[model samples]
Target: MIITTAGRSPSKLVMKAKKLSTSYGLSYKERGGVSIESLKEQYQDDIVVVGKERLYIAPLYDESNLFFHPNLAMIRAKRMFKGDEDPLISTAKLTEGMSFLDCTLGLASDSIITSIAVGSSGSVMGVEGNPLLYLLAKEGLSSFSSGNHLFDQAMRRIEVFHSDHLSLLQQTKSDSFDVVYFDPMFHSTIDSSSGMNSIRGQAVKSELTKEVIKEAMRVARERVVLKDHWKSDRFAQFGFTQHKRKTSLFHYGTIELN
Candidate 1:
C-alpha cells in the first residue's frame, strides 16, 4: 500500500520522517538527501522507504524469508547451487556479453547480482512497480557498490524503472533479453512461521497470472526463470517445464521456452 505523508518539500518530509521514525523505534537516516525510515510498524512486512511523496512497501510471502533474507543470499548459494558464490548471479546466467531484463525487480537483489555477472560488457534493466522499493533498492545498490567488484558494472550495466511489469514488457522489443527473470509475489491466506513474518504484512499477496507469464515468455530470447513457492501451481498452468532448486523456504523454478 502507498501512504502519502503530509509535506510539500524534501526538508518538510525529512522532518516528518524523523518524527515517524522515532515512533517506530527506528533511527532516521539520510538517503538521497531525504531523511528516511525503514518502517517495520503499521505494515508488518517489507522494507519501508518513506519519501516526501509516499511511503512504499511490498509485502513478503511467508516463505519468501527462506530464500530472500537480506543476509542469506550467500548461504542459499552454498546450499542451492552447491557452493557457488551467489545463486542470483548464476541463476541469472549473466555473462559478460548478455542482456537481462528483471521483470519483477522487487528488492533489486537479482538485478544487482546480474549486473555484476554481466560486468561492463552487458546491461541489466530492472523494472519495479513500487516506488518505495525502487528507491530503497537503488540506494542499497549504491551502498553495495562501495566494496563489491560489480561497482563499475552496476553503474554501467544496471538501469531501473518504476512501472508495472506488464507495461514494461510491452515496450521492449521481441527477443530483447537473453534472460527474462521473474520473482512474482504469491498470495497466501494462512501465514507460515518462516522468517518472512517481518515482511509478510507488506507483501503483495497476488500471484502473477498466466497472462503475465505469456508476456515474459514473448520477450525472452533464451529463458524465463519463475521463482515460486513449492505449493504454487501458476507455473504449471502457464505451460512451463520446470527445473527446481530447493532453498530453505522456497524453490527456484526455471521454465525454458520453446
Candidate 2:
C-alpha cells in the first residue's frame, strides 16, 4: 500500500507518512484529492494519512469509515465499573490485575475495554491476523487519545501483535494469562455489527477449531471466552457456558479453567 497525505497536508505530516511507509516497506507518494486510479498506479492500494494518528480507508462506503480509537471500548468499561454490566467482563469474569490475551482483535474494541477493566496493574495482549488491521489498531492504540485518562491509559496498555491466534496460543506457556478471548468473524453478517463491513474485507475469515480451543484452555488461567452471535453453534462446539442477556443479539461464552 502507498502512503499519502490529505488535501491540506503539511510538511510534518508528509514526513510522518514517508517515515511510516519506509518502516512498513510501503511506497510513498505526495498528492491530495487524487483519483482512485492514481492511488492504484503507485501504491496498488491506498492508506491515507489523516491527522497525526488517524488513517481512513478510502472510497468510504455506507458510512463505513475505518479508523481506530479506544472510545467505544473504554466507554463501555467505564460504565461497567459504574455498576453497569458488560457481556465481555461478565463472561470472562474480568477484574483488576488480571492478564488477558485477545486472540482476535478485529478493531481492538474488546481488547481496549479489557485493558481498562484490568487497570494499570494488569496486562493485555492482542493478536490480529491481518497486517492492515494490526497496523491500524496498534498505531491507534499507541498514539490516539480520547481525552480521558482511563481511555488513554487503556489504549497505551494494550500490546498488539500481527499474527494468527492458533499459532500464538500454541506458543504461549500454560496459564500465561488469566483469560484467553476470541471474537472471530461471523459466518453471516448482521446490521447490528456496526463498522464491521470495513474490516470484513481484511479480517481473518477462519472458523474456530477444537484444537484452537484446546490451546486457549492451556494458556488461560481463569477461563477462555468467545463472543459470537447468539444462534451460533460455536459455543456448544467449543464447550463454553453460553450466556445471552435479554434482548441481546450477541452471545458470550466461557470455559472456566479453575
Residues 1-258, model 2: lDDT tens digits: 556776677888888888888776767777767854566554546455555547755522224445665556766867975889776886788899999999988668888888888899999999988766777887788888677777788888999888889988888899899999988853233224444455566566656999999999999999999988789899898899898777877878899888
Error of 2 at 187 (Å): 13
Looking at model 1, the pairs that clash are 45-199, 46-199, 58-202, 59-202, 59-203, 60-203
* Global lDDT of model 1: 0.58
lDDT of 1 by residue, 1-258 (tens): 222233244677677667656644444545543222333343444444454434443333332322222233333433533535555556555577788888777666556567656767787888877544565555445434334343434643578787788888878778888888887763232234343354444444435767777788889988888766767786687765555666534455666665
Q: Count the backbone clashes (under 3 Å) in each candidate.
A: 6, 0
Runs in model 1 lying further than 4 Å from the true structure: 1-92, 143-146, 151-156, 186-206, 246-248
Give each model's whole-structure lDDT.
0.58, 0.77
List TM-score per model, in order: 0.61, 0.87
Candidate 1 lDDT for residue 47: 42
TM-score of 1: 0.61
Poorest stretch of ten by lDDT in candidate 1 = 61-70
For TM-score, the strongest prediction is: 2
Clashes of 2: 0
